[model samples]
Target: MTTDNRSTLFSPLTLPTPDGTGFALRNRTILSPMCQYAVDRQDGVATDWHLQHYGAVAAGGFGLLTIESTGVNAAGRISPRDLGMYNETQEAAHRRLVSFIHSQGAAAAVQLNHAGGRASGKPWLPGTHGGSAPLEDGGWQTVGMTDQSIAKGYRPTTKLSKDGIEQIVSDFAAAARRADAAGYDVIQIHAAHGYLLHQSLSPLTNTRDDKYGGTEENRFRLTREVVDAVRAAWPDSKPLGIRISATDWVAGGLDVDVTSRLMRDLVKNHGINWVDVSSGGLVSTPLQPSGPGFHAVLGAQIKRALADTDAVVSVVGGISSPEQAETMLRTGQVDAVSIGRAAMRNPHWPAMAAARLGVPCEDNPAAPQYWRAEW
Candidate 1:
């Protein structure tokens, strides 16, 4: 979306997409992926809750909408109820979701992930089964790419063998193909938030001695391979993005500078279209900012650092206002601002902002059959 000083975050910005697809930001606003913990246990199917949640978000007019984290392997799940794309039934359910979102004129993307050692845990709630559980609680032994020691309630995983590594890559590629077949517009390889891929990226967690560990290059190898494999399986016309923890937010963890270089490589070397910037989630706990637009500055810094690279930067976290989102885009700091908790609280936020800013509302027009007199 084009904008000037008075854009107020409602302006449209044309984002550069990957080969073969058109992925323009309808506006500078997006509905960031947030795990809804909604899945059917009987068959790993997406229930009415999933449909209504995503359908409303599409109707809200966000430029791009990503489905919540979905596991590529059974043990990769964060919670038992988390969605999966490892099977045909799950793929069918996702196809229905994609159809619903496209009907609203918004793009649909899915974040494929592996929970790593964090899998087989209880629901994310206070005093309610935090961390990985024991076998008795229906938690099978968790695994990772290395033999690094794990904390309490979590078991150290058997390091993935050469064949296992190949299998993991295949799993990601298969999932990407499924996403495409299911009618998804964009495909995101989840390498952030201390998940399987991020675990491989962080030196703090990946302590392997082979080609996949020790040095930063080795540490980044697995993630890069996954990116390459997913891109190969996914159609070149569609945009492929990766969400990364720009900073682990720990003193000893990966720094933003190194990650900035990595982003450049992904863009310049591998032709990645965008880097969805997020932070922390490396360890059980890490330092993080509490103020609004906390991650915006980091995203801006990354954007400036990669001025020579073709990758567009997108920032998440603490973005709650139309004005703030607009300012970020107008200043040329971030290509797009994504809303997480805020969008969850108010699904019509995009439509409301469009009305306030006097921009067109082509993305979210409520059907007359549903809300004619109310409008």
Candidate 2:
């Protein structure tokens, strides 16, 4: 295949760093952070399963691998088995994973998160599909922006006090520092999917009357603080990013227009260099669109909104096809496409996508050992 025939999906991208030189990616394919919930013990450490799971994806050819929703503190974890970044042991384990990802010629990012009202839930695995885990089963009390339960099956949360919010901010900063120590090339603050930050962002979830709630400015306060804290703790030379749910897919909830303004502010005012657009995790609703490239329209809206800024906008949600991804980039829908369930089904989705898109065999991003197997 000639260079002119090469797809934009296989093109290199540079996410700007504070230093202005920018961080380079081999391609526009990013592995969306997906929880594995494979930690055998509830110690908040990355296990061998994580190493192998992420290592395979790194070698499979993703330009960047965003690790799953990692807890900034023990209580912030989504489940007892979820990974955490608050302690030295977790930091060291993360360092090991980053080393292997770098060895595979891919950049590594950690999605630092606090589940808030969604914490202490059972893993989304067999038998325990969803809902809160019991106290005897290792679940603990959850905290959130309000005292209400996020969903019917989830436990009601203790509303975070002003001091508690301060502590959560500190925990995020400490986790950012640990991520830097672990040699991660990027830090993606997880503000989406109805987690702590998202819980604070949406009007449906945040009914508080304090400075952290009420008006739009107040709803956005916690996210801004988290971004500022993470940026301060992370290296200036490394890019800082965020993942946000663009809409709640319901009335009186966040919509693209609202989130686009938020993304613009985050990119222009804050130090965020990348924005990964996703939607409808704040609450379960049938209104959330599905099918191939469902979030591309939302991403396009955000990209146009942030046209004046240098932020890279990527979208995730049912983006599985190479042609579909190429069409999105070629048509200026999004800067990149984040592969989730598709990548899980085939870790080497990028390599296969490259071949399908007419990229030369030599230029394919597959592991050398597996290159012999035809795409």
Candidate 3:
């Protein structure tokens, strides 16, 4: 409903690269990282659920598809079954999924993450009707930057020593290698949503007095180091992206101004190509200003703030329609749009959007066995 007639969301978008590799998207549509939690732990396999689920989106024509925030460490998982990149067993499953997505002409992207303070919890548990697993036994007893998280009912975390920081950076590089092996064309570092890296970036959670905390520069040290390490390990042919909270939306949290400055530094200095703008996920009672285009406005502002930086920006959060997305793109508020919930609601969203905008494209790209004559 909040559409401007002359928008560019339907137009083809080509992203810039610091490494001089050329990549062009058929459109500005992107699929943000949304957790599917459909992995089998025993064999580390992705079920037909993954193929069918993601295949639908690729077939539907989203230009870029970012898989969920895959855990770099097993204990750092958001849930026991969350997708992972720590070992070969997990990497093989992702490879199969990516092959199918690429065959459909959608760019495959992966979000590598570590859930520091917010790790391991059952998404749904019954009350009193049955017993459940603790985070250590499959519930959330994860560590954090300080002792404050434990007081808030989260797991007490070991304050990361310099060596621990180095290991995390190593984990991220390994994950990027796995992504490269798995045929991912794009890699996104998940530093947003109150995760491990974001925790280090925030003063509210990260209370360390050492180089990893204190001043803003110190706070950002971990993220910068991680990005640099990942850039080194990842192939120069692929574009690397970073997702940031943009605005924690809570008092004493990382706001857009800080995030904007960080975005500029990450892009200009560290060789990051894109910044996926999402908000919240770091609070027990997050102050989310829920509505249409709320986060998009933040995206617009951050993009403007970083006008000098060459990094391409993608905005996600409550974007429900192509019309709304186009308005933002046409105005150059953001370089691209990422839709999650809406795409889940309609796997054919991109196809529907193309039709609405009078673009030429296929509705579904799955095997004929799945979507035959109907498509």
Candidate 4:
């Protein structure tokens, strides 16, 4: 998506994607991917909760609604209850959710992820793999670019061999294939929040003397490869996005300079249409500042680095009101703003945001059924 001078957040920006060419969202509001951990325990498939939750968010007037972190493989899930797209059954269930979201007037997207060293727990005994739950509770060994443990007592990861790396890449591509079949308009590769890809990106977590680690390029290799694989498998018309932790908030870890360069290269090479910016999930660091729009600085830094590029940028973290989103977009800090907790609390936040921004209810993206309630 090319950036143009915009007067307000209500203005539309077009995305250059195969299926979404010139795809302009009506507003800047997006329902950020918030994991519900509400899927069928047996198969990790979307159930009634997913349909109703996503449906309400779409009907709430968001221009886009992203399904939470869905695992590409069983072991990649944050929780066994997390949604998965590894098989046909999950794909069929997701199709129903996407259909409902689209019917409510928002484009549907899915966040594909591999929780890596963090894969832990199941539905009944929900907890971290080792600390809170035992292997007998349906946990298993996890993997990462290196054999590293994410926090105290978290499941230790088996360092991914060359074959293991390649297999996961294929897994992501296969998940992309399922996402296409499931009717998602967009796909977001989850490389943030100290997850698999993030652990590889940050020096604090990634410290291997192998092809998949050490240097910045080596650390970035797996994510780039996954992006390439997913792009190849996904349809040309839909947009592919990458969620990134813009900074690790610790010295010698991922920061704006490192992340910006990587993001610039990614957009230039992989045809990524959006970059969702968040921070400080790599390792525990007291340096993580908390406030509304704290991550916007990194988001703006990335946007500036890619000023010549065509990728759209979004910032998430503590963004609560329409005014904040408007200010950020109006000032060119980011092209869009994703509402996380706020959207969860009120699914129709986008519509209310529109009203707060003085956009007429009719002009907003509200459904007819919600016309009177929100308009």
For model 2, the superposed segments whose C-alpha errors exceed 4 Å read 1-4
- Pick the lDDT winner: 2
Model 4: per-residue Cα lDDT over 265-324, one tens digit each? 888888788899988776877899888877888889988998997788998988996788
Q: After superposition, how far is residue 287 of candidate 3 from its true place, in Å?
A: 3.2
List residue ranges in candidate 4 displaced over 4 A.
Answer: 1-7, 18-20, 121-132
Pick by lDDT: 2 or 3, better one? 2
After superposing candidate 1, which stretches have Cα over 4 Å from the reference?
Answer: 1-8, 15-21, 134-137, 149-152, 284-286, 360-375
- Per-residue error for 336 in candidate 1, Å, reads 0.5
TM-score of each: 0.92, 0.98, 0.90, 0.94
Task: Give each model's whole-structure lDDT.
Answer: 0.78, 0.92, 0.78, 0.84
lDDT for each residue of candidate 3 in 1-375, tens digit (9 for 90 to 100)? 224553366556666666586577767789989878676652335678888999888887788899988888775666666888988878988998999998887889988988876666554344421122363545645656775552244556666668877887898899899889989988999998778888989877888998888999999998999999999988877788999988777788899999989999888888898888988777645478777776888888888877887778888888886678767777788999999899999887776776666553343333344444343
Candidate 4 minimal-lDDT segment of 10 residues: 123-132
Best TM-score among the predictions, by candidate number: 2
Q: Write the per-residue lDDT of candidate 2 for residues 140-197, one digit (tens) a residue.
A: 9999999999987899999999999999999999999999999999999998988999
Candidate 3 lowest-lDDT run of ten: 124-133
Clashing residue pairs found in predicted model 3: 59-365, 134-139, 135-139, 135-140, 143-157, 144-157
Stretch of 10 with least lDDT, candidate 2: 1-10
Q: Rank the candidates by TM-score, best first.
A: 2, 4, 1, 3
- Model 4, position 330: C-alpha lDDT score: 76
